[model samples]
Target: MSTGKEELEVEEDFPVVDQDEVVEPPAEVAKTNLAKRRTIDALLAEKRLQKELEDYPYDL
Candidate 1:
């Protein structure tokens, strides 16, 4: 039963947020997060390599 004009009017009632206005974490927090991410990435890479090696054992 709602019309298109009514939907458009409803959408205008909310305020829009600008990306620049968003707040960022403090430098120390950002650094900690980055370190944690790197550790996780390294662990994932190690696991993948181990799996690949197991799949194809080498004779030396």
Candidate 2:
């Protein structure tokens, strides 16, 4: 009887999770992430241009 009670308690302690309930990023979140990536890319490109100008000041 004690073992059965312990089993029931253990089962009740853990809630069941449904596989179908997945967490998805919102559209706004995706857009924000894209914008952030673009900003980072732009910054990197600007830095590269500065480095290139420093290396070849006479070319420009």
Candidate 3:
């Protein structure tokens, strides 16, 4: 039971959609992302240390 209606064929419309396929980020993106994460981790660690230092003698 096949009516060969060309317009209904998926392959005909595939090329247009395929052309917009996602491309992986360039190497620089990985480097920058790593640096960004390191910077954030360092910042959070510093904040925690500062908060700890603030309660040196324990405000009891």
Judged by TM-score, which candidate is best? 2
Q: What is the full ranking by lDDT, best candidate first?
A: 1, 3, 2
Q: Give the TM-score of each candidate.
A: 0.48, 0.51, 0.49
Give the per-residue lDDT of model 3 (tens digit) for 1-60. 668765663555544456469686766678898999999999999999999999799767
For model 1 the local lDDT of residue 59 reads 71
Indicate which candidate wins on lDDT.
Answer: 1
Off by over 4 Å in 2: 1-28, 57-60
How high a TM-score does candidate 1 get?
0.48
Which pairs clash in the backbone of model 1?
A: none
Q: List the residue pairs that clash in candidate 3.
A: none
In candidate 1, stretches whose alpha carbon ends up further than 4 angstroms from where it belongs are 1-28, 57-60
User: Residue 41 in model 3: shift from native, Å?
Assistant: 0.3
N/CA/C clash count, model 3? 0
